[model samples]
Target: MIKVGITGQAGFMGNHLFNYLGTKSNDIELISYERDFFKNEKTLEAFVSSCDVIVHIAAMNRHEDPQVIYNTNVGLVNQLIDACEKTSSSPKIIFSSSTQEDQDNLYGKSKRDGRKALEKWAIESNGEVVSFIIPNVFGPFGKPFYNSVIATFCHQVVSGEEPNIHSDGTVNLIYVNELSAAFYSEIISNKNKSTIKMIPFTSTKKVSEILNLITSFKVDYIENGVVPNVSRDSFELNLFNTFTSFIPKKHFPKKYIKHEDDRGAFVEIMRALTSGQSSYSTTVPGITRGNHYHTRKIERFAVISGKASIKWRKINTDEVFEFILDGKEPAYVDMPIWFTHNITNIGDEELITLFWINEPYDQEDSDTYFEEV
Candidate 1:
């Protein structure tokens, strides 16, 4: 059982790391944490110092200006390195450097500097350090804003729009699952040696092929000469495959879910969310008929048609969070355990929700816990 600490635990890569850690059912103790150095360095360092393997992931991911990128990416990494140097007991540092070649762009520069910094720190501390220069990583639990080509492309396709490409560039893409596994393997499995392995891995497929495999959804393939020469099956299984046990399972009891919402209001809502458009109006209410909540159960909800507010409270906390269902939002919301939550039909006619859960309904673990209709 190895102790692990993950920084940048909230962004696309961070979320991927956390999701992977959450699914593990091993003696391994994983502590996933996120830090935006611009926000809180003290808390970030404290978190990094808490584990045996410190996975540093936070940095300025994408930008054009060299100074801007260096200041945000390289500069911040310097802070993390400094923190490690000062630590009474510095752990092995696993930095998520980019796979982009030695280019001059801000993104590339920062990643390069990060790699150097980690090497220097490891040498100074007489401790081991590993860096995985990952290529395009894409899959579930990934952020749509940055990281891989898949999220951006998937957003375009799902919104019924064409993606704009600067050039006909084919990237080496790996599923999120694969990248996560590689991370774990290098950090815990190979922590004994002070070696740097530049994995110019082979299992990379085109973005179009990846999009097809994950979902049945279709898209108009735009951008001439952009597709690569990789097979569909070639893109499966990587670091992320090991993290599948952490993912929540399907959870919708009974053979049926209520209300089909015939008018397609829910579909429009999903369109709006996916397109990154806010303030769209729903012509009808989504829930043509009911109010519901689960006891000791968790659920994930996605908007299908018109816009609506999902009001939910944590099981034993007064903290409440309201999310507006949209296509740009994640496909689902993770409901809390033993929480009282409900979706109101805020649209003009009817609203719709596409939801699922981690487990099936067991009478021993199921109930409305209330009898108010």
Candidate 2:
């Protein structure tokens, strides 16, 4: 079995890599080097010797001291190379570098130098290295208030704080899952390279566009039962999923505004994409609800309170079906796709019923035809 070692396994991309590799890592032995790995000298050497592949994910990117960032980043490569050499092992090294290597800043120069150093060591010692200059990566479980804008925005908005945007410049984004897949491929495919650029399948969006979409998703989905139009595009859905992951458990079961008067109250209950929607309504005595047939949407009707009679009929058939049910029974009847159906209050009390549909309501193509049963 091939052994793979990951440094900084708890960090964002590192942890994501560990998880994605689990899908097809059955033949590979996995090792992790946390923050304390460098402190213990013997363990670092032994870990390098034990692995057939090493993913170097540890680095100081966001630091107050420029000198520290430069020194730590450059020193990290030297230490990794020295440890592997001391063990007399040529384990393939996967170094996670940043795209800032092209810039003239301190962080950029240090990363560029580190890449050069890795290349030099690989040539002189006849070792294998995969140095990847990756783009901005963001996904689930990323730390908020750190380097990830998506994570921080999700956290601040969930916490009722405004997102702080210094500029509305467009930002390139690559999901952590995509990067993790790249890591797995390098480890398993045995690809040796001097410098690898992970520029595949990145999405670009303006800062304002991102924040506005996420904000609209929050207001429309959480406050109201309306599912945001995340189905319109790929990035919208990704952003919505990321935003929902940060929502605290206490935020669930949120109440919505109900339009009520002397008649009764009406409100949208819940919505989903493929699984459909759920809603409830109350009807006075002798009041009948729903006289419609849907061509495609599968529906369910349950008598939640009082006594009710649910009736249905095929569009062009003389046969009519009726089900007498009460709240005490607590049973639901699934409505067929093309059946015209309705429910009526047959008792001397308010009849409450819950409804579920297989798809959210669409005005343009409602798939609903009006008919009386």
**In each prediction, how many residue pairs overlap at the backbone (N, C-alpha, C within less than 3 A)?**
34, 0
What are the per-residue Cα lDDT tens digits for candidate 1 across 33-70?
Answer: 64554367677667667788877777766665657867
Please report the candidate that would top TM-score against the real structure: 2
How far in Å is the alpha carbon of 308 misplaced in model 1? 22
TM per prediction: 0.58, 0.69
lDDT of 2 by residue, 232-329 (tens): 22566557656765766444223334567899666544455535678899999999988987644556676757988888785545788788877754
Error of 1 at 79 (Å): 1.2
Model 1, 295: alpha-carbon shift in Å? 24
lDDT of each: 0.54, 0.75
Candidate 2, position 25, lDDT: 52
